[model samples]
Target: MAILTRAGRIELANAIKQKSIYLAWGQGAIEWDTQLPSEPSSSTELTSILGYRKATRVLYCDADEQGEIQVPNGRYKIVAGPTPHLYCQFNYDFNDGLSKSIRELGLMVGTKPKASTPSGQLYFQPEDIEQKGTLLLLEHRPAIYRDQGVRESFEFVISF
Candidate 1:
């Protein structure tokens, strides 16, 4: 196998980072346990698009807790998972930034279903929407790296 240099890895990582939708349990919570708004999120109580990607701490990814990517939905911009993000810590794990598993609940990443379909966008489980539990303190951040981390701001998308 070929080895990636630090710069190469960052470039590759950044390139792959875009085209993805991400969610982290934010400092707020949704207490009603409701279904995700299948309609345009504008009409729902989804959190505003501000303060996303502000978590400067390094996020920890794991083997067991990887994302469940799904096929393309005519609905969302990027299609992926419908997994229930039932849990995640309210604050960033500031210890070492190299934790094996994340403190956040479920993490959704990977491809939308199809041949040659792209990967990395997140998806919501229709059943998990409005299930009547506390809302996960969610921070929806999409990683769209224009210059691979040198862009003005990181691009995040709530849907898809």
Candidate 2:
């Protein structure tokens, strides 16, 4: 997968400065969705980095839990599977040491997984415009182990 280039990082910084929410899907070749409700136009730098053209398809969905946000003028469903961790990426400028603060806060609230259980890590690259910033949002889920005598279930974030 191609990581966000320097120019792409710059564009992301600008988007954040403008308070625009940039949406991308996929572990590789992210498809940029619609501009945030507050932003007016898409980021050219971001599009270039993604190798997007006029013909490329962008899928948009609501940021809310109800999936009220829409692009292409329709409603859609989001699905997810059970995992030990939930990962997220953000296109924002993390300057003024704000990113560090956020990371610290997350670490404090986040639970540590058992050494015997499998663990997951979410990676994020913050825009360059931000000073010493990389946004890595991680949601850790506790591991469950059971034998034939017991049944176990897991919780996941899904949109439907």
> 100-153, model 2: which lDDT tens digit per residue?
211111111122222443333222233211222222122212221223344221
> Largest TM-score belongs to which candidate?
1
Off by over 4 Å in 2: 1-72, 78-119, 126-160
| Local accuracy of candidate 1 as per-residue lDDT tens digits, 1-160 | 8865555544543443443322322212233233232323232223322111222222222113233322122121222322211111123222312222222222223312333323431222222222212222233323222232232312122221
**What is the C-alpha RMSD, rounded to one decimal, of candidate 2?**
18.8
- TM value for model 2: 0.16
**Model 1 TM-score (2 dp):** 0.21
